[model samples]
Target: MLQLTDVAKSYPTPQGPLFVLDGIDLRLAPGESLALMGESGSGKSTLLHLAAGLDTPDRGEIVLGARALSSLDEAGRADLRRQRLGLVFQQFHLVPSLSVLDNLTLQARLADREDRDWTHHLIERLGLAGLEGRYPEQLSGGQQQRLAIGRALAPRPELLLADEPTGNLDEGAADQVLDLLRALIGESDCALLMVTHSARVAAPLDRCVHLHHGRLADRTP
Candidate 1:
């Protein structure tokens, strides 16, 4: 339920304005998954930020469902993010002091939509049943990442935006995390837009698109 049309983003440099995304067009429907692939400096994160409304694009529009992000003020965007969007990143952004259960329910509680059943389901499904009282530092890397993913999903968001979600883990752990992620997304019928550089990481997604020269180039692999 996300769409980007004629999107272009640039930043000022000593030389001149450096465009990172030029006329980028992409769409992710509900229950669909997309992998955004690119080399460093290809603007994959920029595009993800635009879609998440974390940063505004210099031009073009990003629409989440029926809402146009360009029309929203910062507060509105934050509200939208809280209610409709779930975000995961390479670095697990867990609160160090909060218990695993608290972290998982934080966003949902903030949105005033915490569902205990769903939260408990997330805990069990994420393989975090016995570790509810533990803090982020107490868990292993994979466990921490799973907790992060669970936290993001606790709110039952319409869309999940992940940037290098498995980057910190070993290959085996990364694959395991990806499998769990896709399974959870499927069970919830949530759309996924994951930004990653590895083709292997992108391989399990429904579609993969490469970002080249500030544009999206569709590729089967």
Candidate 2:
């Protein structure tokens, strides 16, 4: 569903251009899950952003589904991201003014694809059944993360991109969230490309790759 070939990215610095990703190649098929493991400054997040259409690489091709990212202008990329991509980050990024249910359905509504049945199903599966009326501030960290996951999946996105999704929670809560996320992703059959630094975080994924010096190598079993 997502493909990156010869991808390279760099940014200007006082010294010179600092390359973050160099000749990175990756592929994630439909319904497949891959964990991207890297240390800080390994370019994992940069690659993720490029795949999500949030940024363009300096070189190389990124094809989401059949459309090459380089071919799309910013507006076109935004539209595609809105319609086909689901994003989760370390921060919940919930609307403070919106209730749990509204937060969950906001993206779907924006995409003009809101389905009540699916929203309720997400609420239940997210363990947010009785708390629909509450706001983000009222929920615990794990609850907030679950709500974020529900919001992402409410539209039934074709692929989900997550960055340190459980970073804010304790170990117990992180496990719970991961379990819920894995189960939901399975039920929806959406491909996943998650960036995490923890080996434990990458263990359950179908495959894992490590990013180092702007290159990718499969994690040795």
Candidate 3:
């Protein structure tokens, strides 16, 4: 459902141009799970941003469901992102003023595809019951993270991009969040691309690809 061919990104540095990714070639099938493992400064997040259309590559192309991202203008790319992509971040970027239910439904509403039943189901599945009226600040870190997951899945996106979804939680909370995410992803049958450093976190994925020095270092067993 997603493909990257000869994808490369670079930035101007004080010394010279610094390459963040070079000759990246990746393909993800529908409903597949991939874990992107790398050290700091290894460009995992940069690659994710490119895949999500939040950033454009300086070379090559990113194809999502046969649509080449480089060919789309900014507005078109933004629309594509709104319609086809779901993003989960490490910070749980929930709106501070909105209630949990509103936050969950925000993106779907924006995309003009809000489903009340699905929203309710997501609330229940994410263990967010009876907290619909509460603001994000009122919830615990784990609850907020769960809400973030719900918000991402509320639109039933074909591709879900998660960056360290469980990074901020305690071990028990992290396990709970990861289990919930995995179960929900299975239930929805969406392709999942996650960036995480922990082997325990990456172990559950279908494949793990390690990135180093702007290139694929190893495809682990």
- Please list the C-alpha lDDT of all candidates, in the order they appear: 0.94, 0.94, 0.92
- Indicate whether candidate 1 or candidate 3 has the larger lDDT: 1
Off by over 4 Å in 1: none
Candidate 2 lDDT over 73-184, as tens digits, reads 9999998988999999999999999999999999999888899988888988998999999999999999999999989988899999999999999999999999999999
lDDT of the structure predicted as candidate 2: 0.94
Q: Write candidate 3's Cα lDDT for 104-169 as tens digits.
A: 999898888899998988999988899999999999999999999988888888999999999899
How much is the lDDT of residue 34 in candidate 1? 96
Clashing pairs in 3: none
TM-score of each: 0.98, 0.98, 0.98
**Candidate 1 per-residue C-alpha lDDT over 66-179 given as tens digits, one digit per residue, 9 for 90 to 100:** 999989999999999999999999999999989999999999999988999999899999999989998999999999999999889899999999999999999999989999
Candidate 2 lDDT score at position 150: 89
**lDDT accuracy of residue 26 in candidate 2:** 96
